[model samples]
Target: ELTNRSFEDPPGSSVTPSGWYDCGFEGETPPDILPSPTLNIGKTAYHRSTYLGLTVRDNNTWESISQELRQPMQKGACYQLEVYLARAHSYWGISRITGKEANYKEPALLRIFGGFDGCDGRQLLAETPTVSHTDWRRYVLQLEPALKPYDHLILEAHYGDGPMPGPNNGNVLVDSLSNLIPVDCNANPGLNKNPEPEFAKRQMLSPKEADRDLPLPVSEAAKGEPISETQLLELITTTAPRIAFDPAGNLEHSHYTDPLTNKGKWANLLLKNILDGLAQHPLAILVIVIPEKDPNLAALKKQNLKEALVDLGALQEQVILRDWLEKDVEKVWYGNAESGVLMRLIR
Candidate 1:
């Protein structure tokens, strides 16, 4: 079994978790241990109290970790391994190339290598496709080293064959590694399959049509039904214009002047409607639907709207952000960014 396989560390600590040696580029900082109060990017652990955060910097230097394997990986022997991976929406760092702060928010792939010693990446064993999801996802890799037996394993973050520009900023979360299970070398590992968890339990509270195929919640809120969901949605959207995000994830027309009020659109009418609804029904909640494309950009959109709401006096806890998964993958490039978000009031 792998030591500290879950990448456990003290809560909110940035030190490297025990059992793994930093394999980062020379003259650069080591990989960070995350969810610290200062690094507060809201990345929760996939298995335990903490997880490993690695980045591929814009300067072309990436983060990695290495450890000695308990047993040698024999040549021609197929091994199946499972690992959990994710992409953080906000991984901030200073760019060595430009001398400015940058968000390492792009998606990067995880590569595994086998070698004889420390940080040895001489033999490429297996690699997962770019991990773009914000939630914890398990990836299974089949490794069969054609070369000689090796005793060390190195995990690296590298820019695989992606269309993005060279040497861009990206990050990947690592946690909950599984032991390498020996398998028949002749047996086909087949295609890589990523099992998506059942749709979130918060779907019932979303503004989208409830008839869509998705898992439902187990129970309802305890508050008395002071305002129906329909009534609450109507009240909030009555004067509030639909908000959309631009290609850069910036809010567009969200603050256009209302002909009657001549003020920030959301600042004046949208905020009033939300506060008014809460006044009548204190148990009501605001749900902000965010798109599921570009984990980082989606996060940007959610943060922008949430900040707007909080700045205008809506209690932070009262606002919720739900991800909208676009079923048709082909439309990701062509879909309207404005339709990405839909606000709803639910109990």
Candidate 2:
């Protein structure tokens, strides 16, 4: 079970709240317990009156809030972790001189890390892409701790590689954290089995009605054979190849020399296809991979993709954004620049 899931108790404080502790940053300030609906931030917590607020600095320093679980999470158990997160969209840190809010556009970011030792021995579990939304959005991740039981979780906020810093600061708000719930991995509900119910009913159509209503399948690719629905479902429910976007933020064409007329359009179509697949596979989790090179550029691309998905009505919690180190990228898809977002379905 989780305590203070909404950060509601110990009322009206800007310091640490009850049942949670500030995970220090060694010579930096601790996280704050702030009123969510304040005039400055202008948003309420997903659940209650208050939420945890954290900041990232220009020097790359950040802050974190952590809690020790009521019971240890069992090893190898599949558990769902959910939280509501939002970026300030515009916030300069608490002013030292005037104590007033300064306006800025630095993107607020949050990463979830789990561990056996109190906020130490942690491994990067899941994180959001550049959080630019002022509204609170839910984010979910399925955690299967492999080697040991984890009793602690940390939520760290930082300035992602994008967004120029003002007085070296950015902020993120967090609320409504959920306790881990074990999932029955083998159970495939009929709802999931029939991904598109309305389309499935099309079989009831008379041949004449079908001919009039259903459009013929049009293949777009020039060479590859079409995949079966079963294959498509498998691809949606299982892990996929790492997709890398163009480093220069060009979603339109694979290369500058490529004679593609609708590069951007194709990129949007690819994203829409992935979103459609996820909608069919409700249990599937979406993860966005961000490369380490040029954090600012990576952050911007991540934010843009996330915004596009959000516009398509994807829940913030159902998707995860993670950063990839240069070495990690090379290990998988080496020398590919035009690749777009990579996705993996949670097992």
Candidate 3:
């Protein structure tokens, strides 16, 4: 970009080269960003040969990875974020740092449009925990469009504490960038499907037959009327741990994203209204009226909330509603029936 008048890093380094990527020397090439301290990964992760390389500074810190893709997301539109991540080093002993060091947590950061002019797009969406093991894992996250339209996108990864683990602590590799307006279902599902041992229970709490019920207790906090929020919170506090043992839906995003979606215009208003009704009591059940045109609505109505720790402190034990065929598919129900009347849990 020397003669072409394109952007370059802030001085002190060699002149900009004509290539697909520009590494950080005295300073990084403008636009193309770095996710870490050292810039030396191969151009691509699973390419025929070499992969872009970057240096990891410490542990539990996030490195922002971004690109100069000039796509302006509308103010009210929704967008999905997706990328692939893997542990940098294969050998454990060869890692940069281990526990209790600088890069302690080995965090990975996937950022979007972080440091660009005009737009304040520091949307660091997804994070991978301290990765001590070696093996490539793909992670995807969904982000709402910023209030202002942004042209650039940033991707990043961070090390929590010290250096790579004792020869074993190594760099985390991230690649396969995919985002934008293209409606790719696999890219922006807002869910992590593979974590070896998924936190999802087989199903939500379901009744054994049709009228099974498990209700909450009366603690004299209120009269013989409806349950109180303080009492409900009290019950949840005692039961969060017990339910955590059999976590079903998303534990993290459920609280973080779900609530916000309900309030936003981009979200499904019908579904939000149904959920609002169920919150009246401790046990909430919601049913969706599916139309024939939207066959996928059946699938979407089901909540396979694994890592988000959904349905915490469910009154009854999570019952797996068996199907007639009993194939690969399984069903579940949530309910509470100890409060005089056996009220089934809302879906």
Off by over 4 Å in 1: 11-14, 160-163, 191-347
- lDDT of each residue in 113-141, candidate 2, tens digit only: 77765667466655666667666655655
**Compared to the true structure, candidate 2 yields what TM-score?**
0.48
Model 2 — which ten-residue stretch has the worst lDDT? 191-200
Q: Provide the global lDDT of candidate 3 against the true structure.
A: 0.31
TM-scores of the models, in the given order?
0.56, 0.48, 0.34
Stretches > 4 Å off in candidate 2: 10-14, 36-39, 94-105, 165-168, 184-347
| TM-score, cand. 3 | 0.34
Clashing pairs in 2: 138-317, 139-317, 140-317, 161-295, 161-296, 244-339, 244-340, 245-339, 252-263, 252-264
lDDT per residue as tens, model 1, 183-290: 786564452232222221122223644332332211111122356555665655542333344333434322234445565332323344445556556677766666
Stretches of candidate 3 above 4 Å error?
1-44, 58-65, 90-107, 113-115, 118-121, 129-133, 161-170, 181-347
By TM-score rank, best first, the candidates go 1, 2, 3
